[model samples]
Target: MFLPPLNPQLGLRRQLKTIVFRIPTRESPQKPAPPMHDPASTWNTLKDILPGTDNTVATRVSENEKRVLNVFGAPHFALLPRPEPHRSPSPYEYFCTVNESASHVEQPRLSVTKLLTDAWCELQTFYDVFAGLPSARSARLSSGTRHHENLEKQAHPRVDARRVEKQIESAAQKHAPEAVEVLFGTPMAAQLASQWSEHVTMRLVEMADTCELREIHVHGFLDLARGSLVTDAAHVRAAVLVNGVVDLVRVDASNHTQREPWLEEGLLLVDLSCAIPRAKATMTALSKDHFVHVYDVKTRQNDTIPAQRSVLDAARRQCMFYSRFLADLARDSNYAYQSWLENGRRRRVEPDAPLGTGNATELLLRHFETLALDYLRLARGTDLGFDDFDNSHTHRQKQNVDGPEHASRYTLSDFVSAAQFREMLAALYGQDSPFLELDVTPLFSAWKRPLTLRYFAARAGQTCNILEAVVPGSVGVEYHNMHTRRLLKRMHFALDGATLTAAVQHAASFWNGTRLPTATDDMKRCVYCLYKNRCPVKNRATEKVGERIYRLCESQDGACENLHGA
Candidate 1:
């Protein structure tokens, strides 16, 4: 028989994982000999013994110092764990605190991303608003930010320094020249001068690459100061805030073969959004025709998916979100849709955006064709970011290599008996050749979570396959509701205004500390959550040690209180 090792220092303070030990004999003492030395001190001594062999501790200390300085130096920087989990303070306390803090100032506007994040994990949304926790500066985030910054810096073409110096001299004769002496005398001044030159060059580049002929000023946001093809400032900020930098917005893209009948009418496309290494959306919106093409440019190897439908459907939802954002802007009172007339200046056209109205369904349906093709060709079965792409040369076709099929394999032993979970599919859908032959259902669920086969119906509500290219009038995939384990009655797209508004309103309620963040049944998300320490949710299992009982965040605790407002 094995027994847990006991240490006087810890006194069972730390959790142990069924450590095995030999039972003491009658003559021996019950307590195991105390550890020879403190684990931490021993590790440090080892490190000292092997100098430079490992600098992890030193490196961590230096990184911490840098991080502290960076946090203190930056304005509006309040660092917190990723997917900030909900914490203490009763609902009354939270609401009272929010009012106490921001009472004088107007509440901040709710962002689309924030809302979507909440939809993904209600608990995360709660922490985002009520907690006032600063977003963590993750490495992925820093890398993406640097990449975008590099691109933006490249916006202004470089010019010969000597040429600029000569121009500066020429300007001195007519106008007061900027301080030239400081450029050479001070490093800060030189850096400033260099920055100013880059700014001036950016304007020159923008001027060189103008795009305002058809829908004058609609070509690009080259010079926002001079005025953009967009109607106003609010819309500009909205795009940047929600989607970051607009990658490329141009009017009338050539390549007629790729263009549809509506292409002849000429189109203004909001081609690409910000380039986050994780998820980069290529949304092409034709405002006038009310047609949009939202492309999912996933590189694979980025996301972790639970169900194939979960992520595939999420992409469509993201696209619709962009469509809605643009539609709202198009319909804004100040927003004047512009058109080129026989006259010199482009005339302001009337708003005819059909994103959420009666014809909204058709327009959204048209966009679905491209999404379906992408699902088949690009994303394969699942849209998990972490899913591996097919390497043409190295990997074999019908290969036994690991992929989403394995990633989505979850253990449902917690919910059902192992025999039932693993054998249920074989009994129910066994006779169905493809479903059974393809191993469509869980044969045996793992102990971690339930494994269930999922199928998603397209907008048309029919069975769909990856091999087919979705056409406007073609039939769709048969509807399947993974949760209900039955057929679905309605479509997710072009949801009426009230439904959409309600969702946003629900998310926005968190600001008032009215809606508490909720824990999802999605165990994988919880496993990856960085804020589990303070999270209210606990796993189903609990361990009682001494006076205190320890519990993990993964428990199926229904009482996972939304500490902000619950």
Candidate 2:
């Protein structure tokens, strides 16, 4: 059950039309002049250069390959395998806060995807996050993925110079034009070519001015005439994970509004440890002072520029949510950064060392909020394993009581960290205070530190205009996104205080047996939505098996009718 918007539509019956009332007048096809196979015309040259159907597969490279090496960093071999966090299925219907004291209550898990989708339509998000339901992929979405994956293959440096010509031949055989929408779809493929032209034109202009002749690794699009590659998807791989999980952690920090510390203000995390190649070996420029490098090597795939712009705008809020998560983790636990030195030894870093990417080869404990005092204990917790424990808290308690291993590989720094973490958690969780105060120096270091998380959401920044570039990576120019930011500032990642009061209210109403209204906005998202069959807002729906078709009507007890895009 879901609640309707405060202001309902004036006439719902008038709007729910199965058939498109207005149709475009059809025009007869006219005979056109034959395409002049002239040298001056670009189309003629494109026909000659664009390879015919053959091998479409570009030579795919591994993560450790020479080209992507700089962007993704070196191969990470783990010291000890880490297990994933356990997750419980979330319910869409929000209930009264369960009294865990009387009986155990599970906290709802919220993600950036959930928050963003919830903003779109509460019911859809409820189905996604709460119901744990999976939706079938739409045709457009599948095509978009294919298109983006194609660009990724082309971005590899191996596809450069003489190799590119051979790759073109491969593409000709495998990537046929009419066979799939990804290869030569209008607007998407056309828009990609158009944007690629802009990048090549500007780069050529700059090259002419500087009289530069040195070879540089260019990206997705290539120049058939100059035998040069034009970079396209460099801006796309800012830093985000393919799956839903973003590196998440809790941090302690002062509230921007009240100027005081807060709990439940958790930070969302992104670990870009391998972004810069040489930086990791040197361990200096990589992670310097306040900033720690995070990498997400994902590509963009938006059809339009304005749509891409909108995605970049929405990402700021997501980044803010992540920053807040880090701040909360710092506040609640005794967290310190320890790095492995070049001399085959790990040492205690200052209050802010893990914040740096230097010597961070291990991606699992790459950088985490220490929930306890001593890191040695943290190591022991991992040694025992996660299978026995039901939850994070229970896992921590059992790790201590089970007796630490004597023949363990725990280091000196780990011992100190484990002790401090234990002490910190004891005092903080013991007494009930409006807000917990963390260690003086660490908290102070975090206070002055400007918290920020870098996002490379593939869908959003597919067409983000270039601001700065370092060959494989590009930065997007920031402009004020006031309207979107204002809306985002009101929401919190976790339910704390009044930040998520509105969200909880909606959930509570639904769980209380309130009938949730359909948020389907007419034809906007209804046509392609997987939930359309069950959705009330949809006036009509069609189901097909291969060539056969069956139309589903909204009116009760109505007979089936044959229709196409009605």
Candidate 3:
């Protein structure tokens, strides 16, 4: 039979999974034990018995000293000792307190790497739970089996510094010089940077290397700035390919310039708005009022829904996160800061503020208000539904493993049991209904949030180019969303990145002697080639002399009898 333990400390707090015990014969006690040692002194005496345990009294005194100093040095830094749950104040309270404490400005030196590592830990925690990935150490227990050991053992292993350093070094070699430095504090950042490096090295390395292009400049707001073109043709080609729309503007120094032009012969005018990285996911614009404004072409139209409370809440959160992240970008590199000055010279700039973070607070608040209004209206009584989808979720999950055994094993069967859907819908929609939907949606449902997959590309101009070369004849302003996912997909071919680099090299060799050979070599027989068909890169195996196959197919005059020889 289960019984309670007789420890006074245990009586105060009930720990989960703790063993319980009780005295068998309380009435039979004839005499009380000799005066027990004082509770406080006894606790102190036992402290040294625990391995690696420090003297609590000394630790507490030190902590108190630190707290006092913190208060005296910068009162704003003296946060109250948070309770167990550790929650910050409400948004209003938080902002008010921060504003009130603005008089004492103390810029504590922050370690970017430490911040990144913490963020990665949080991200992994969320992803592991959300994606339902199999834990490396989940174990089966018999009925009535204790779960303590299993639970403790199932945790993801801690990362080692050496492994992290290796990843960082790899990232520096492949993606960009700044990638390694920018990833400080994020554990997954190192892994992600390495992955980006591998991909960039495979696809963009050869093209850039052949053209004698060196570095890629990524603008914090607009897009990218490309460097190292050996010839004017290469630069023009890069400018055309990198940008979707050529913004007609003079490159005046006073107006501010964030560009790195090798030749100052002419004003550098390139498209900022249209150039989207190929691997970006589809995007849909919505009004501040939560109205459906536009749909991204790649997403399924049927799944696109109007902004509701949930949508707006998510948007506000996203905008704030992005704003903060962009703020960090300014401090990450000299180029980013320069670009901000050049592009935003006309805007009212802050002298002391980092460019990215300059209007972050206001922008975040404004965007949140706009989204909130839309959500409020939708929640009141708006009849609207959203429908935009793709098999991207499935595709991403598939990337974790290589073969049939590694395929998307997560089926609907895994989540149908329990009150999961009902609980979720209740939280999201504020009501339970038979019409409520439940399925594993993509991890990134909103455009404002960062994507798990990133597209690493290299071009003649800019660090993060936004042009879409997937479907030809739709150049310039015709390109669509250039989010992480879309940019990744685009680089698969044009960039021939880490995973597909070998395939591109082999393809380049196959079409060495043919006319328009490089195109044929790069597109056909290439694993990364997503647009082999109708692209000049694909081999002309079916083409015959004097035959206009492309024109014949594109025409509306019933496949041109003369061209087809019908």
Candidate 4:
């Protein structure tokens, strides 16, 4: 080695072979022969023998062990395939319970309010029905309710004035000698008389030109197809019962101006001057001479005028639905007129009755009868003081002569005679009714009438129309704060049949079990939702985090490698 460092590698290899030759072989007595060297076995043996020398080899071995343990033992990671997620039933299915006794399922009824709520947040509405969540009460809601009550009271004055007039007339006829003295002698009676006169005069004026009806209840089925699709009749009959109360219906005089003062006044006494001027002014056709405009009133907590676009859109759609239903009721040719009333009555009596079982015309007649009775009672001042009356003046005088204790009280039938009540009914609901007819107008003209939505602040004296303030120059936009001298903001919306039809079809899809309830995209709406806490879609952050984790796990398993690479 000192002579020449020649072949240093050969010298080392020779020394290693000499040491191996010294070791025992298979034929030796002390030990078995060494196993034949296999390249794979030799490499694995080296990896185990020199554990700290090669980190890559140790890691690969450790991973293989883990994979084997995961398959056989109680490992930390999941190795089995994931299961499919559980799905919930749709609203229609959830609400439509199966009747064990019968072969059919009970159909679910939908309301315009519910449909509108679904439009705003289908998830929230679903929770409301499914979970039976109590509606949240707030100061704003209370204020709105009070505002509606006030409007109703304002409308009642005309009825009250008629009642006072009837009392005055009765007093004049029964106690002719002391009629004037009795009326003017008492301060209360005199004040009531004066108020009555003023109200009657104002009512007469209002009747001649326009009338405002508040809280008109309306109901009908949602026509999902609108004759657009060729579907089965049974599919079409899937239409659900939709009902709602219209906040206001404004009836304006049409070009046909034939005034029947007697009909307009609705007075017990008919005079020569009250005669109908035109032969066309029959009981059934009066609605044709009017242009009907629908309105919806909304109250907000702040002075913000127009409200968010979502809010305005909802309000517009709600008003349009109300208008459409009302127009349908007013049309003689519409099937709803013949079926709505009976259906309502049947529903009232048998809440779980099958759909499309009752008649609407009969139900309407009942409503008219009730309305007539109410008007007659109010006009006769039964609510005020005229509680007792008779057909003959002598009988009335005899009752008056008797002490108050001995006087016989008149029944509702006696208070307002059947003939008189029927007359009023015919006047209010016959062809001569004050409501406008959609059938008489040009196509879509009735629906096209400008819809006004008025908003009032929770607190008084703060209001503005946000739409008018934001975009003053928009076309077909009329902004006004005329109500209560700027305390209200009114936005006018033009009815769009296409948009309304689309919305109806969309909403109907959910009710018909064709679609799932959709969560609102607007975060602000979620903030106000009563079901936000438990809503599946309210907190997107958690969902997003979970989705990311899922994707990462999938990529690690090589299931989503392409997705990660992309």
Candidate 5:
């Protein structure tokens, strides 16, 4: 069983409790504040500008509408046709490596697994550089004054103010027509809103104590206003842990300390706290012979063990599958370069191997060690389908094997069935299962089940449906809505949004403690009223809002439990 941390209070258990505490504290209301009769104050209050109900009023706009295309504030559209079932090329076809005996090759030059590993490693490095300690030393960005001096030293161009203004107005009309009105209506004032929320402040501070690099200069306090939306110490700590695991596995595999790259990669990033209630299942399943030890929190005992084979294999396979699942995200996308860089960086110093090696542990490790070379060959053994194969190495009898497809070897319709997978796996490693005999139905179930568009996009890849582009079909309203909902849920959490967005934008920046920026204008203008500036969110909208709320609650002594501050 997964050993709980030595102190029984230092691992995922403590962290989860902190997350649960992020929810607002509950108390019986003794009295209510007098309704504000002041119009200005009412408008400023979140309760006034919107409906109390959850129903959203936003509707999809026409392409010709004179408004900025803000994804945030857009209405749901049910008009698009449904996306067809995804038709992935056989997994073997895309990611399989060729054998050494092969004389010809047609697959992509690089090993897909290596590419994924490299990308994962770079992501970790980025997190390490910017995450961890808030005050860790690194390159500092120029501040408001320094930026102005640099701008002054730059070359200037003479321009007609009237003409320039006219051009700007024209551009606004063509581009951000909706924003133009909003910009004009508001005063020339803006706020650098923090992303950190109230719930994570204390945890962030605790996490910040462990990092080596630091980017934040502001102090992070649990009671600080609008702190949840801003980056904090806890975020950095989580990123380091995640990236560290991934990087470690890659290092292990490269150095011959581990195998099964895909499994290792997958497990490294799983949200264990949310996935399973306790560490027991993970530890027992992953650890073979080694006993899981919990060291005392105060006393540093070296109890961690060498990476287990089953754990490594499962991790590596899962990671590759995840990457393959997200292949749609990599194609013709801006992140392609970053993906390439990450892939290149993760590789071991050893030579590359081919894809599609037969099912054997020694062979798998050997092949993984020489991935670059093996992948160049694109070898497929003499098997049209995994179904016909038996456990014995030698065929029971010489049957008449005939048909043009069999003769050509070029007709690729090889599919791996469940039985075949089981048989092959049994053959490859000879039945010494390292994982605990826990029900893994859920693991397969999650993947086997049809997924919403957003879930597919968020977890697998942003763009899995290549057919949507080629067929020019619409994502059905129901599917789109489902996808949107799933995606929104994933995005709502601080960890997922921050990490994914940071990965997209800075490839190197680990999203550990970073907060998601404010919703886009469209989201801000959505038909739904929740999460708006005026709503009673767990964390206050702006720093001023928190400070005011704190003061107001504090003044009304004993009226609210939160008067002491949550």
Candidate 6:
């Protein structure tokens, strides 16, 4: 017969002795001798003799003493349980809070990115937004950001410091000679002078016509009930504020090739001198207009070139959303004009308030002013005095050219006034209104056409393997290897109005609190997800812990066991 060991911590000799003495032989049943030392006392003695044992024992003793004192002295307080911590608000609630503060609306503001992310994996997006987790930084993201910044720099090139200083000196000589000393006497003064000119130069560039516009900001609201752009707040089932930046707006004069013969024929009989043309006179008004094409660039890792079906779908929706926003802004001339005027008026009244307090118009204006002031302060070492400029007049009065002696010093205030600035804004808005009307079509109509998605692969900080996808048009998606430049695979499809609408509505339902965020059906996505460890919906069967793997078993308690042991 076998006997199990009683005291696991005992020495082999001591355990054998205890066992031998306890087992009675076939001879006679005798009274058992007592143990030389109590098992508990022996364990206590061994614990005291071991290294670091005193510290551990002291800690345990102190904790026990404290517990005893608390029970005896303040039993009522010690027995009381802690109130449960306030539960964190859900993603939808957090969104509402942000919306109310920014736009003074209870409705949540959704971005093209957010909508796409929701479509990709609503559960992941929920954790991202609710927990406010910072996006994981990787080489691919950094490469893409650097590339975009380079592209934007091409549009608004830095002003030459030498040229700016020369202009400042010439202006000072003509108007205020003493002002030159104040401007160029110190390094701080000289720096500020350069910044002022740079700001003015950039503003001029923005007002002027450019063939390619990078990072054009756009925003508007979508009405869920009518499936149209929201204008008034009244009689709305629900409104979702959508905003996004157009990566690139290429002014293509070639769009005229797509113009129908009937459109051209109709335009020939209409009057050409009118400022605003009728709907039928689209071609005539568009004669001088250039078509604008929106492009969104996505950077991917080497393996992600031939993206999954879900990723491709998300990209298509993102581009469509951007195109739709641009079209809405372009088609509604009255709204755009009014928004510009209202924002400018508000900006004038409360110049100190933050940007993005109103619509995109206010956001743009405030951004310009803030940047201008920042540059000036960096150069001049002081706030460029806004009080120096006159705001009494609605328009700047033309001064006599002959009165050089009477001319004021060259300051940003003298270069542009509040009313003049507003006019410049109007002109900027006016330039694009006609072009957007002629080039952009409604979302439903535009979706019928094939949208292109370009995926760039980066290697050693350089981008290559430009894979382009013509959705709904091509049969398969084609991937190009970054190093070898070899074609990998092909795939393609197009979007329809109903499909796009359904996808958007499904995503909106989650945001509107109609349903909770659902986990992605694609198990592959969960493998690399940052929140997989904590996600309740994660596939526990495939969960890897150190060198071991586990699989969920169909037990009543829903327990998981090691695969090796199973």
lDDT order of candidates, top first:
4, 6, 1, 2, 3, 5
Model 5, span 176-268: residue lDDT tens = 555445333211111000111111111112111221111111111111111222123333212211110111010001111122222322222
With candidate 5 superimposed using the best TM-score fit, by how many Å does residue 337's alpha carbon deviate from the native? 11
> Candidate 2 — which residues are off by over 4 angstroms?
1-108, 129-131, 134-303, 306-317, 330-400, 404-518, 540-566
Q: What lDDT score is found at residue 138 in candidate 3?
A: 22
lDDT preference between candidates 3 and 6, better one: 6
Report the C-alpha lDDT of model 3 over 215-277, residue by residue, as the tens digit. 112222211122111112212322211101111101111222122321111312111111212
What TM-score number comes out for model 4? 0.45
The Cα error of candidate 3 at residue 176, in Å, is 42
Cα lDDT for residue 119, model 1? 44
Better lDDT candidate (5, 6): 6
The positional error of residue 141 in candidate 5, measured at the CA in angstroms, is 32
Best by lDDT: 4
Off by over 4 Å in 6: 1-90, 96-108, 134-139, 155-212, 223-240, 255-292, 301-304, 338-495, 540-566
TM-score for candidate 3, please give it.
Answer: 0.18
- Alpha-carbon lDDT of model 1: 0.29
The residue ranges of model 1 lying beyond 4 angstroms of the native Cα positions read 1-110, 128-131, 146-290, 294-316, 332-499, 539-566
Q: Which consecutive 10 residues in model 4 have the weakest lDDT in total?
A: 452-461
Q: Give TM-scores for every candidate, taking all chains together and pairing residue i with residue i.
A: 0.31, 0.26, 0.18, 0.45, 0.16, 0.43
CA-RMSD of model 6: 20.4
Which scores higher on TM-score, 3 or 5? Answer: 3
Evaluate residue 74 in candidate 5 and report its C-alpha lDDT on the 0 to 100 scale.
Answer: 34
TM-score of 2: 0.26
Tens-digit lDDT string for candidate 4 (56-124): 221122342233233334232322111122223444444444222121133245567656655467656
lDDT of 1 by residue, 1-566 (tens): 45567777877644547678988767844544433423344445444434433333321223332332233252121232222223244222343344334521222222334445444566654544344444457665555455434444454223333443443344234422343231123332232222221222122112212210110011111111221123344344322123211222122223211222211112211111111110111111222222222222221223333244544444444434443443333232123111111000111111111011111111112222112222222223333121122132124234633345433433222223434322433433244422223221231232111111111101101111110121111111223233232433322344245544444455444433444556666656765554432344532211121112112212436422331123
